[model samples]
Target: MTEHGRPSAPSLFDHAVEEIRATEFRDDLVVREITAPAGVAPFSLAVAADIRPEVDGVDSPYGTGRFILLHDPDEPSAWGGPWRIVCFAQAPLEPEIGTDALLADVAWSWLVDALDSRAAAYHSASGTATKTLSKGFGSLAEEGDGAQIELRASWTPSGSLSPHIEAWAELVCMLGGLPPGSEGIAVLGSHRSTRG
Candidate 1:
């Protein structure tokens, strides 16, 4: 314990933090570290990001999300290991796309596909994908209807945390309608574009 009387974070946890700090995400994402939730684990790190395409004159984001990493050296039974990753991703969807009945399943599949594509191994993984539809009320009827999709998931990490984090970032980009490897590619139909 230091002068503050709190137990110092473990060296392994420090290393994990360093790994996260060293990682670089896709250019389209605006990522920043945030305070982790207390009491969830002995050591935790969290990041939040917005999918901001660089289309000229566009200021709003396509979506936003958060990724949290939790580590407990004692190895929590429910997690199956010392490391756990929890993520939340939400994106506005085209009204038509939101009406699809398979949206939830598709969203969940995106996460699975992302992890598999990166070869990130894990178990005890579980999550929920939800689609929400909203219509303007009496005072706001001119606003029209809107829809969104949200994905909340957590999983155990079998090896290095970098891949898992990368996969999560990919999933966020996917939900935001940005195709994989879209870096440096101009986003068509962006607000700045006059194309119908």
Candidate 2:
């Protein structure tokens, strides 16, 4: 190599980065690259998105989320491969739904379903789904009560990342109450279950 005396050949990780950049997502989801966290891996990429319906005039988003890709060419033993995908999604929920004991389980299933629908191969998947209920008290009593569901997950991807990214985008849409491939059709309530 002319510079640094290192070979210039692109690595597999470089190709993965290109694939992620070229992938297209549904119009309802606004995605943009963000700074990835330090020390997670030798190579990393991060993206943040908001699930907002263009047809709807609502100023607030139904949900917001982040997707992070980490690659360790050394093949970290715990990752089972060179790549790992980390995801976090949060969406507002009706207070009653958030109080349901099954809410956490349902939220976790959404991610599993999203990856499966895309035929995204992965393993070592693990995560937690949390429901947060907020109630106004004291001087803030006028704000009323509200609730939300948050999903955090990490898994090792087995192949091309394009499908994985698309699946993640769909997961964000699903968390925001939009059905898979729905474009912009707004649903009355959360679409927390798999449609089959």
Candidate 3:
């Protein structure tokens, strides 16, 4: 331990956290640090984000997501490196759009595209894209139907961490109905279900 007696954080982990804090997100996206999940690695950092668009002067969020950066000095075999990033992004979808057979594939593509576009590199990348549909019951029949898409992904990261976070933020915005490169524009209509 250092003379100060405080357990020193790994330099790589500290740098990663600093880079994440330095990254700038879209104006409409709200990001904040949250309790990182334990048992994933010796060091971890997590953040939560929401796409909050103004509707009639009220802030309405159409999507939300989480990003976690895990580091292990041992370089776990599955991770292929000391660093692994696990991300989750979910958003409500219009019933019609959700019914499309390609919806799940499209969601996965978005993640890949985001990473490629940012030039974030690594291997052992894997994840799942899930779509959930719900129909209101008797008492809530008037609420109609609803659908939501969720993507869970993890990958070892190489190079700077900035681009990775930015890409994930873009994915969150995309799933919220805002296309990439869209800034200062609010999404039209609400995907949020009246029931929930």
Candidate 4:
């Protein structure tokens, strides 16, 4: 029973469904490919899912990507009956940027901005910031230091999966910092790198 008046993709149970936003997703994100289970942590969110979005970056040597849209159960004991929308973003690390805290701060903002930009209503928003730095060891040799950013988030959804997808789409854009989904990928020179 969402605003669109649809009965909701079968109530996260009746059958497998490809939940979607009015706007289509990027090729990098295969909608039907995502495979998640019913309920993640505790409250049994059952309607959980996942998707991936990628893009060319600016400062880093490599491109960028994000693991968008994960919904799960929040522990009843910890949060008092709330669902968690967990999200993760992975992007190329720019050389010597935001050494102290701005990076994490900006990262969190992406989630908030994503949610706000789409007008996705929800309650009790909270999440964690994680950045991993690991270089190839003796056996696992590599060219240079390996660095990546992971943004994990979970919140209680106020309504249906529609708003969630809208918010999730925004997060994908924020993580990759891509323009509106309408704009196609431009030439390297034309497309300024948004690597952060």
Candidate number with greatest lDDT = 3
Estimate the lDDT of model 4. 0.48
Question: Could you give candidate 3's per-residue lDDT for residues 1-196 as a string of tens digits?
Answer: 4578854558668878999999998788888898999998999999988887444332245888899999998889999998999999988888877788999899989989999998998789999999888899898887799888889999999999998999899988988888866777767447467322
For lDDT, candidate 1 versus 2, the one ahead is: 1
RMSD of 4: 7.1
Instruction: Put the candidates in lDDT order, highest first.
Output: 3, 1, 2, 4
lDDT of 1: 0.81
Candidate 4 residues 27-78, lDDT tens each? Answer: 5443332344444532222221223323222223223323233322333544
Clashes of 4: 3
Please provide, for model 2 over 1-196, each residue's C-alpha lDDT reduced to its tens digit, 9 standing for 90 to 100: 4387753334666778889999998887878888999999988999887776444332224777889999887788999988899998888877777799998898888888888988999999999988888887799776567788889999999977988888888777777787776886765464432110
Residue-level error in angstroms, candidate 3, position 160: 0.5
Give the Å error, residue 18, model 4.
5.8
TM-score of 2: 0.85
The global C-alpha lDDT for each of the candidates, from Candidate 1 onward, is 0.81, 0.79, 0.85, 0.48
TM-score of each: 0.86, 0.85, 0.89, 0.60
Which lDDT tens digits does candidate 1 get at residues 6-42?
5545877898888888889988887788889999999
Deviation in angstroms for 55 in model 3? 13
Off by over 4 Å in 4: 1-23, 38-83, 98-100, 137-142, 177-182, 186-196
Worst 10 residues of 4 by lDDT: 42-51
